[model samples]
Target: MRTGVPLRQESLVTPLRLPSLIGCALSLALAAGAAFAQTGTPALPPADEREPIRLLVGLPPGSGVDRISRVFAEALSQRLFRPVNVENRTGARGNVAGEELARSTPDGNTLGVVTATTMILNRHLSRQMGYDPQADLTPISRFASLPLLVLGGPGQGVRTIGELIEVLKARPSTCGTPGAGTAQHLALELLIRSVGARCDFVHFRGIAGALPELLDGGVQVYVEAAVIGLPLVREGRVRLLAVTSRVRSALLPETPTVAETVAGYEAETWLALMGPRGLADSVLVKLEAAAIAVARDAAVVRRLRALSAEPIGGTRTELAATIRAQDSIWGPVARAAGVTAD
Candidate 1:
């Protein structure tokens, strides 16, 4: 026979209902206060929530774009009372990070540090990109511009654009690109078509991959952003034939402009910080201010110049207009060049 022990009331302890009630009430009140605080005003960051500001880049580590973004991150952290973090999400010629940024929340927390190639050229190249650079992304600020330089490999013994043109006329030489449909490729295309120069085109995975071929005398000339070309010029690994922009680069002051010889030649690449479109005015304003302040910093300017980049800070409207202008200008050029994304 089983004997059932009498159950004691005290044995079954009840939870502290009063404390739970109090906690729930407190949580509701705090949430209500936050909601009320944000009701009429822009969703300003909570005063106590010092979350990290993520600046996403589309280039690999140690790249000029990455370096400039990191430098701005340090400067922005000082300007904003929060930590600034840079994340590299490289692929699709920078369209990967551009797409990510375009689809991200427009809360001013996530930003894309992008170049004109991603903004202007990739659209012309790629047929099925996930997002539209001009439509999905809001350009908050233009940070910098990098001019491209036309350089000659050892085979030509060419010291100037004129000499290089002469050599190309004498014999067919090939120019190298980081890849097809890149800004570098477009520059070479324009150069070749403009002057009717005879040259074959070679595509590499990146400037680094193509650089070895240049050094081995496999490619005679390459048009690359000064950030990539300046180092080789300094090391005597390559000779700068000419820069594309009208004015000479501060980093390579001695290198003359191809524009001087081939008038109307310019392929200056730009870098900017942008966020998802429809970002609230308040958040957009703060981000724009932060970016402009960082670009205006003397230290930032010096560091950017060291990378052969020029710092340029402008309003959202200004950046948007620039994007539109570039789209108009390069869209036709890209089509004419028969550039397609790989």
Candidate 2:
């Protein structure tokens, strides 16, 4: 009887052990899968199996934004082993492009290059803007920043911010800007208000239109991107009094920043990648990685430097926070300055 009891107990224990081993294997497999996900190695579709990516640019071809977008598109294509194309959808101060991007499918195929003007200033200036930047888009990363240069023409007779302020207060100095609500215009307005100086803004259609006027002294001071102004400065057509970046630019280390003289003043235009809302975490991770890789690439860095723009790659959270902060700061300034596009 004891031998029979031992055999039955052994049979029961064997079945229980088989289930326990299977459960342990399943637990290990699950843990490994979780670990892989945590490492940003989530399973993505094969490059060949995915559709070509469309990089929506808000400016026309040959514009600064378009040029930067093409650089990033090439790098992203190489990284993802897929084709990427730039689509120019220019109109209504980038509202046309922003709306298109916002309305795109949340899938990773469609992305847009956004600027400080498009993401932060447009909404405050135009009530007809179709999309809300904070709600309609998911910021992927900020890839580059273009610093504005404070330029003085022949008649200005100012070589520094202090001299410029004194000139403005002494007489009626005219400042030329690309447009009413443009980054250049806003920066000039902010500077005037911050320093409590009297300066009038002359709105021009574009920088090309403003350049000749500036050279002829019709416009005493002109604030524009370094890329556009630096060539003239090099030729001695204009003088760079100060740069609007918080730190001295690498391209022009001899120049001082506006903050050095104004106590606290900085303004720059930035380029960032963003997608429609509801983007998957895996897709966001992949996009951000590709952007950062491009921003850090030696060749890409050189190209950006040539354009007088600096590579600044950071996480999505950082881009979102920048939009929020800039919106807060620029909104009230725009209102006070009576800057409106529409």
Model 1 poorest ten-residue lDDT run: 40-49
Stretches of model 1 off by over 4 angstroms after superposition: 1-49, 169-171, 206-218
Tens digit per residue, CA lDDT, model 1, 1-342? 999999867846677689898999999998878988888443455674468878899999998889988998899877777788999999988988998998888887888898999999988888989888888988899988888878777655677898877877778888888777788888888787778877788988766877777877888888888887778778887787888776887766787887888888777788898898889998888888988999999989999898778888888899989888778878887998786886
Q: Name the lDDT value of residue 340 in candidate 2.
A: 76
Tell me the lDDT of model 1 at 7. Answer: 80
Residue pairs clashing in model 2 are none
lDDT tens digits, residue span 290-324, model 2: 89888999998998898778899888989988888
Structure candidate 1, residue pairs in collision:
none
Deviation (Å) of 87 in candidate 1: 1.8
